[model samples]
Structure formats: structure tokens, C-alpha cells
Target: GGAGGGGGRNRGGPGGGPPKASGKKRHRLASLPPSALLARVERRGGGGSFPVHCVAGGKLLELNQRLALEPRLLYDRPCREGYVAILFPSPDAARQLRSRLLSESEYLRVRGLSAEDLL
Candidate 1:
């Protein structure tokens, strides 16, 4: 199985906004492989549902309960406090993940986004 770990992002949301809380379990204790379903983020007004997946194979450590309680955080500060879950990958998986991650500039270039666009 592929290495699984890391935080997730909600790429599919209304106006490309952050994901809404699914109100599911706050803690997941099962081992998951890469691309496994971690959580589901649904839009408030029946917009659409997005599934948050595991990046690498690992154990789910914790889910951000705050998102479930205060969904505004997802819009106010999506990158900081709106993260969905924490996963601890195996040692080998961690090393593999580090090798696969793109540099900040490379990621920006690939996404066709400039630093100013983020702000």
C-alpha cells in the first residue's frame, strides 16, 4: 500500500471555499491507506458534498472538532484553524511523503497562482 499521511484540503466547495463540517465522528481510530475517505464536507444549502481523503497511508489521529462546532472558521481562516484531521503516517511513509511534496514555488507555478492571489 502507498504511504498515507498529512492534512487534507477541500478542493471541491462552493466558490472554491472551505468545506462545511459533516458533523461525523471527531476521532477516527482505524488505519487508512492513501486516498481513503477521511471525512465528508457538505455545503449548507445543498450545494454539494466533498470528500476529504487521506494523502498517505497511516492512522487517523484526530479530527478538528472546532470545524464541526464553528463552521465560520472554515471561511474566516481556512488554512489555520479549519484543518480537518491529523494523520500520523508510518516512518517509511513519512519519508516517501517528504520526497513527493512540491516546493512552494513549484506548487504556485503549477497552480498558476501568484503570492498576491492568496492574500
Candidate 2:
């Protein structure tokens, strides 16, 4: 059983073009702890990289290898075709993670953005 989430995305509109592939990092996921680093997303055109961390502790079910080849999917269709990894968390871990996640309004408020800003 795999769960979705923990994907990287760009902040600008979809006109920046695709990012070039550079040095890649690999992780061994024999066991995943809560807040474990899953992947690092490097900013296009030379900036700092962002770390993608796991939300819960469990096993890694699958990785979307397609992103390695087509990183643009993350900017184009993040929720559809650009997922980073799939994980199967334990019942307790899943519950805890869900409880801590912010709702849509909560997230927008925390970022000092309104719902219309996302549109």
C-alpha cells in the first residue's frame, strides 16, 4: 500500500522551461523514519537545493523514476504525473502525520496568501 505526497514544485508560472539534470543523489530506504530526507530538489539556474522529507516513518513502496528523466512533470502536473515517491506508513505513523497536516485554509493563512493567489 503506497501513499502520495512529498513532491517538489516550482513557484513561478509554467514558462521557465525545463531544468537541466546535474549531479544526482541516491538514498537507501531499507527503513524510513519520520521526517527522513527522501530527495533534494535543486533550484534551476544555480541556487540552493530544497530537501524533500518523508512525512511518516515506514517502508518505501516505489519511486517515480520518470521524474529522473522528465523533471518538468513536477512543474506541469505535480499531483498527477510528478509524484516523487510512494510510501507505506504504519497505522500509527499515518494517523500522526494526518493529524499534523494543515488544511487548505490553514496552509494559505500560514503563508500569508489567500485562496485566490493559488488560482
Candidate 3:
């Protein structure tokens, strides 16, 4: 299993940035149903669009709905901008799924082991 670590520059602070939305909207994204389409990652330079389908239950759906409104942001900061949608599933499943995932050290240790030995 592949897991993305959450670590980056904080986009919001006293320095000033985009206007923050209400807490109600944030809560909705943090709790999405199963089988929901999270976001479509579009290629830069008009290459193509790739849909980001969600398999897990819990997710932090942070999609920039205003990508169409301000397409320039997509070009300027593709990493920090331009998401089609977002979705989050059940919390219990998310916990179980994460718990089953092997850490970097564990993966390296077991990577070369035979299937029978792994068990």
C-alpha cells in the first residue's frame, strides 16, 4: 500500500491569502460517502485529464472548485491548485486500512522475503 505523507508549506496564515470558507463546507469534505469521485488531475500544457478515483473511505477532499474561474492558478501552481472534486469515507475503515499498511522499514525488510516467510 502507498500512503502520501501530509507535509508542506501552510497556505493560510497572517500573511494573507485566499478567503477561507465556512466550517460547514470543510466538514462536508471531511466526511464523504464511499464510491465518490475525489478529483481529476489534469495535465499541464493542455496534455490531458486524469480522474482521481477514491478506493478508501476516509479522505481529505481539498478540491479547488474555482479552477474554471481562475484557470491561471492551475498553470501557476499546479501542485497547490486545480482539483476537480474531493471525497472522504468512513472513519473506521480508514483507520483499519492505515493500520494494515507497512512502514518504510518494515517494507524494506520484507521486500526480499519469500511469500511463505512473509506469512
Candidate 4:
């Protein structure tokens, strides 16, 4: 837990490290443009098993953040092949991820189609 993984908590997870930021703003894109959250949720990837919500804008969207670590789906489940997990801020981000998935060879065939076809 030292630094082997990634994005070490601002001070580590509630145990020991640097003291957590006192007044660091929480990510709140949902309350920001309003449309940002709506767009993010509408994107294909947003419909997945991971949890999502709108965070206000002012705060920069870090690919990795310390708090509000929401649930992520297993890599091998429906998306990410069990490796990559993403927390999307806006629908466009989701769409970008989805487009990435769609354009890639590994995920393309499985992209944009219905479950019935997969069956």
C-alpha cells in the first residue's frame, strides 16, 4: 500500500500517511452545468455496473481522486475485460470511452449491439 498501486490517498486511506486535505472540494460535476451529468449518464459506458453522480464543475476532474471512490465492475464482467475501471464525469466522457471501445478490435464486435445478438 506504500505506492505500489496508484493514486495513493491524499494521506492514505484513513489509516496513516499525510493528514487528508481539510477543505479540498469534493468532485461535484452533477451540480455544475447540469447538462454535464446528464450527458455523462447518457453515454453507453455510464449504464454499466459502476456507480455515478453529478459533481459540480469548479473542481478539476482528475482521472484519479481520493474520495467518493464508488463501486467498479469486475474487469472480466461486461466491460474492461477485468482490467480497466473508469469513473466518468460527463456523458461525453462516457461516449469517448464508448467510442474507444467501439473502435478497438477486441471490443468492436461486441460494441453497440443488443444482448439478444450476443446470445
Give the poorly placed runs of model 2, Cα more than 4 Å off: 1-29, 103-119
Query: Which stretches in model 3 have alpha-carbon errors above 4 Å?
Result: 1-30, 59-89, 99-119
Best by lDDT: 1
- Candidate 2 residue 71 C-alpha distance from true site, Å: 0.9
User: Looking at model 1, which ten-residue stretch has the lowest summed lDDT?
Assistant: 1-10
Give the range where candidate 3 is weakest over 10 consecutive residues by summed lDDT. Answer: 1-10
TM-score for each prediction? 0.59, 0.60, 0.36, 0.21
**Alpha-carbon lDDT, every model:** 0.62, 0.60, 0.46, 0.29
Please, what are the lDDT tens digits per residue for candidate 1 over residues 38-102? 55665555555566687898777766777666765555554568666777899988999999999
Q: Of the candidates numbered 2 and 4, which has the greater lDDT value?
A: 2
lDDT of 3 by residue, 63-90 (tens): 5657645645544443346433443547
TM-score between model 2 and native: 0.60
Candidate numbers, best TM-score first, in rank order: 2, 1, 3, 4
* Whole-model lDDT, model 3: 0.46
Candidate whose TM-score is highest: 2
- Candidate 4: tens digits of C-alpha lDDT, residues 1-119: 11112221121334332122222245442123322221111112333222222332222333323232421222112333221113334566555545544444444454544445333
